[model samples]
Target chain A: MAPPPLAALHSLGFPAKRLADLATMAGLSLWQPQAGNAGGRVKPTALRVLVLLGHAWEDQVANTWTEPYTAWIEVAALADHSILELIQRARDTSLYISFTTITANRRDLAGEVLSMIGGRRRLSRDSRDNIELALHEALSNAVLHGNLQLESLSGLSVDALERFSNNLTCRITDPDFANRRIDVICDIIGDAVTIDVVDQGNGFLPKPRPEPQASGRGFDLISVSCQSFRLLDGGRRLSMRFPA
Target chain B: MDYAIDIKEQEALVRLTGRLTFNDHAKLRALIKEMLQNAAKRQILDLANLEFVDSAGIGMLLIAREELSNLDKQFILRKAGGQVKRVLTVAQLGKLITIEE
Candidate 1:
């Protein structure tokens, strides 16, 4: 008998409505499993492809189904691409995500990306933690320091923090700063995974601090967490690599 | 992040849960105010349930420690496990704050 024309599109942690819309746009009939069905369990016999978006459903999908081609893609990466193209790219390429500074500030971009990647590949606990930390620093720098052009927290005082907060609020509320784009591109080849975080900023020059302070340890943490990293495009782009 | 604080005669123990990132600035600010106004001389932050933290979170913690120290008060972090523990070690935060395992 011919395989069922239905496709199983699991939202994982991604929004169900978005996934459903994507499925509709792709001209595919979707078979959504009942909500709160333990593990999002679905029989794969009638499915052509399994498209799992987001990372929240990783363990469930892993333990539930093994057959059928699965495309693990981040929902944010869905923009500007046809669903068919995305599924093909999910198999051939990796992930490319672009969002405005406002979205980056509002979402846990690093965590979502890490979870998507982790679902597709097996990352050791330590490696996952390191990647998550390094990515968090990279995204934070791209949003706050690069795109928003905000100064570092100068001192360890409530007043200083308040000033910083005020500055952040002011900048984020401004369209010129908030609307700048930040792009994250990920690629996996052999045993290495490379992620590049690019921002639309004027670029930065790293300076060495002479004293131990409360802030400015972002680069330090990123340096130790990833295997290797490079600041390109005049510091507007941070490229980091990790062991797959 | 969310926190529940227990105030005693000499110390205030705060149990912090959820992810403590830069986004928690407002809450952290409120937490700092509570720590400063309370009569307790020692502020203990329990991180046993805090699942994750970032560089900004670390900076906020430093801010708390510094503000408390200005008034001769002590700040301590205890029971940080998993990812939080690893981040603290990597950031070399132990040299600056008292972390109780």
Candidate 2:
């Protein structure tokens, strides 16, 4: 089957850069499929891009969202087939975002996800703030602890912060650690939004903080913002629900 | 995040603007250290224009409080509104530091 034309993608609300990125990332030749046939036919996964785009386009026309094409493209870059499947099942009711362990990328993804969620629904100010804070904690945990394997809440001293920052910089530059992916799946239904963040790392049990410290308060914040949360996949995954 | 320091008598007023989170750890540490060195009695964090505070930001604020306490100096957070105020309240930081409305 032929991939959708660039015009179709544009009409579907995808910007030129986003469409180009999608084509490159998915290894799809939207304009010249035969020119790239030396590498064989388009990968099946590439076709799913169309399905995903189509879903967003339909949602846009239905007035569910005005502009979701770029966001979908961003998700498509890192999302595995499972995420795509999940999104297909509930495109109008959910959002799925994933990215590598790069700190900036994680922040951008989180920011984009939060913006979309906020724009799509009319959430209370409290609910929006809580979700924003909680999701920040979750993303930080995924990058710093899960993928980078950094120590938590090292120390309150200036020296400690310096050492932590140095170590973090070194870890971020190492491909073995930085290439790992963190996935955020958010399901919004009724007055509740459930967000699940999954990382590719050996997870650890979240221990109770016995004292008020400079670090390790992430769990406390998450607990405060989320209605309920649970660890899954040996702690590699954290799922939290926020109610309106 | 951006911060401005104003030394008024023995008190140093550090006006913080924008989001404070893990990303601003280095800057926050430097700011706190500088405030401690200059402020004779108290270091007041003016968060009137601060829009966001994450858990890490809360943690950093606690760090500032702890360090100031060891110096026998006051670390006061004032004018925090909206999200910053809410996070400070949820983290129960008022028990550890002086939070002035």
Candidate 3:
């Protein structure tokens, strides 16, 4: 029989939505267990694998042991043997690397990503690495929320979108769409192009204070990197203009 | 990853021999949580047999350390070698967690 905690994760995430994103951020997986048990104890390793794979979330790993020592043995044994790949190969700066990850290997997407650099038909190798780094954030967010199926994934989805929140200049200030995992639909008419990205995951929630941890820097990549950007209606939906 | 642990009275020595990574987060987190929950805070994590670490593995370790700290405990990582230590250092997590090489 499966452990009880796994049931909780199933409610949060399943079937997995953004796979490439999860692979980019938070990393693959790991394991943990108690000290020792009598013997033939139930294990929790399988569930963790599911979460890292973007298959599960919120569910705790299951364990069974009268004593603690045996459980730890099982846990440690399972944990001490995995080495994930250091870098991803797909982050090349050829065309627009704009999945839910990068906006433009050429144009700047804003917030935790880089802009698409246009000039030479080819891009220099040095600057291309930054695109990978930037996209890593978006990729991370997409996978993190999507995999966990947490309510926060919604924020990564359409959260933090703020349009004309500042002055009533009809200006928009939504989260950077270039790098984040938003649902974007673009319509091109003559010299004008209309684009929209809709993030499929948990919506936004308030950021909570916590101890020191790495910053989730998806929006930053798009905002700073993108040339001209704007947020619309609490970052729910936004639009950008690029000259042809 | 597999392990052989020796619990002598107050000290529970866990010998971890493998490459900790994403493939094992679930079990590892539960086991570590249980260890911190039921045993002494002064736990020995013997990584002599450890080989490599990924982001998931590192995150698990950090989480364990934090959770243990709440219990006024310390997870002593012993015998972590060459490339393994380098991975921890690059992640900057080495600064927070105890390591012996």
DockQ-best of 2 and 3: 2
**Candidate 2 lDDT by residue in tens digits, A65-178:** 223222242232333454344334333335554455774333444555676577557788888777888888888888888988888776677677778889888998887987
Query: Between prediction 1 and prediction 2, which has the larger lDDT?
Result: 1
TM-score of every prediction relative to native: 0.76, 0.76, 0.36
Query: Taking chain A by itself, what TM-score does each prediction score?
Result: 0.66, 0.66, 0.27
Using lDDT, give the best candidate's number.
1
Looking at model 3, residue B47 earns an lDDT score of: 80
TM-score of chain B of each: 0.99, 0.96, 0.85
Q: Write the per-residue lDDT of candidate 1 for residues A86-174, one digit (tens) a residue.
A: 55434323555556687778877788778757755799998899889999999999999999998888878889889999999999999
Regions of model 1 farther than 4 Å from truth: A1-93
Docking class of 1: medium
Q: Candidate 3: lDDT of A139?
A: 35
Top candidate by DockQ: 2
Q: Write down the RMSD of candidate 3 (Cα, Å).
A: 21.1
lDDT of 3 by residue, A120-226 (tens): 11334433333333333333333333322222211210111111112211211222332233333333234433333334344432264254342322354433323
Candidate lDDT scores, in order, read 0.77, 0.68, 0.38
Candidate 1 vs 3: which has more lDDT: 1
* Backbone clashes, each candidate: 0, 0, 84
